[model samples]
Target: MAISQEISYRLERLILDGGLAPEQKIPSERQLAARLRVSRSVIREALHELQGRGVIETRHGKGSFVSTMVPGSGDLREQGPLMHLFEGHPRTLYDLLEVREQLEGQAACLAAQRATSLDRHRITKAFRALEETDPLSNARPDHGFHQAIVEASHNPILVHVLNSLKNMMLMTVQASVANLNPRAEMRKKIVLQHRQLYDAIISGRPASAQKLAMAHVRFVSKSMRDLELEGSTLIRVPVEQEAAVSHQNAQD
Candidate 1:
């Protein structure tokens, strides 16, 4: 194979193998050349070829980014209308959690089965970040931990789809954390559940990881439902007390 063709293949493999995520910025040509031990001209030719094939895109001032047009990936903008609808409906948060229950569970299972050494390191880093984060303000780190698991699955389609739904997922997580954080018991349970899920993944127990991940989502869903129900329950006011307060307000 030609040198430039070989270079292009290597770059493509980096993207397909999850080394370079969709929409992530690729290293500059100089960086790529140095890393690949190739001449700048060859790096430029390979990048151009990849760009022609829609594997990457370059901006005028910014360097190339991995194209979101990877196999089985779609434009996130296509879901804009549906996402707006979801944002307007409180119940959609539950729907999002339901989706998470399935996707995250499967991702955990795959991660347990397939995680490389680097993937394990990334997952461990994300887990530790979550551990050190304040429970009351852990939405981002928690999301990062889950995202790392999904990426570790090494399924490009799964990674891209979940990344596309990033906004809705974060919204759901933020809601759950915000509502459950005020309850000390619930918060502690959540932290423990996360630890269990992380342990299962790291131990390479696919079944345990899947079960723990699904259960964690279910627990969050149930807790949020309970909190919503509690908020909606009406407290009875004495009729005479209400009447007296109304009468005094009229006089005032």
Candidate 2:
């Protein structure tokens, strides 16, 4: 990893692991640079990365401090519903959804074949907890439940891939809740999909489970794309996308 990244990781670890309390100020840039034996410029760069991720904040006149909203290890930052978007910055919503379908489908398949009794129980508990949560509670059981599946797969490589997907999942969930309807019917469908996947794993039917899991992931990705397009065409305009469209229109 680059020196800046290494410095960022170390600092993040310190804050996240409770070495630095929430709203606690960090050492000066010069002090940090001296301790890490890196240039102050490198420290600043690393700090900027952390700031973008909402791990820390800097006041204009005051020094930097740990963000009070530091997302947990399994937080939306790490494992939420839309965490997949940062991977190479997908060219389009369609491309992003397609990549998610492929990765999550594989995770479901591996989970089905390798899940233990404990994993089944944990997943079931997560699903039950989801039924009790609402958009207001801001509980992210879905991300954790999916991550549990990946962990049950007993594949280190798959875990790494899933890790890459975590941030996208989180961001996606937040976006969906912010804009999408997420009505009762949609909730039922999500619950059913999770149940089917879980049942296939518990029954020791890997192939069937894999098929269902992949189908479910594909369904979600497609839904997101449709919603994005719908929002673009029918409802509130997406400023980010609109800017691109405006530029294109101007050129044309």
Clash totals for all candidate models: 0, 12
| Model 2 spans with C-alpha error above 4 angstroms | 1-93, 135-139, 168-173, 177-181, 232-252
Candidate 1's error at 1, in angstroms? 44
**Model 1 accuracy (lDDT, Cα):** 0.77
Model 1 residue 144 lDDT score: 81
Q: Give the poorly placed runs of model 1, Cα more than 4 Å off.
A: 1-79, 87-89, 169-174, 232-252
- Tens digits of per-residue lDDT for model 2, 1-252: 899998899888989899999999999888999987889999999999999878899987789999987857544334432434444443444455566667667777777777788888887787677556663342356556676777888889878866755433433233443233245675567667778877777777878777887787676656566765666521222222213221110000
> For residues 1-252, could you state the per-residue lDDT of candidate 1 as single tens digits?
889999999899889888999999999999989988889999999999988777899997799999886755453434344655554466776776688788888999999999999999999999999889886677668778988999999999989877655544443333556567657897789889989999999999999999999998899878777877878421212211213222110000
Q: What TM-score against the true fold does each predicted structure earn?
A: 0.57, 0.52
Tell me the deviation in Å of residue 125 in model 2. Answer: 2.1
Q: TM-score of predicted model 2?
A: 0.52
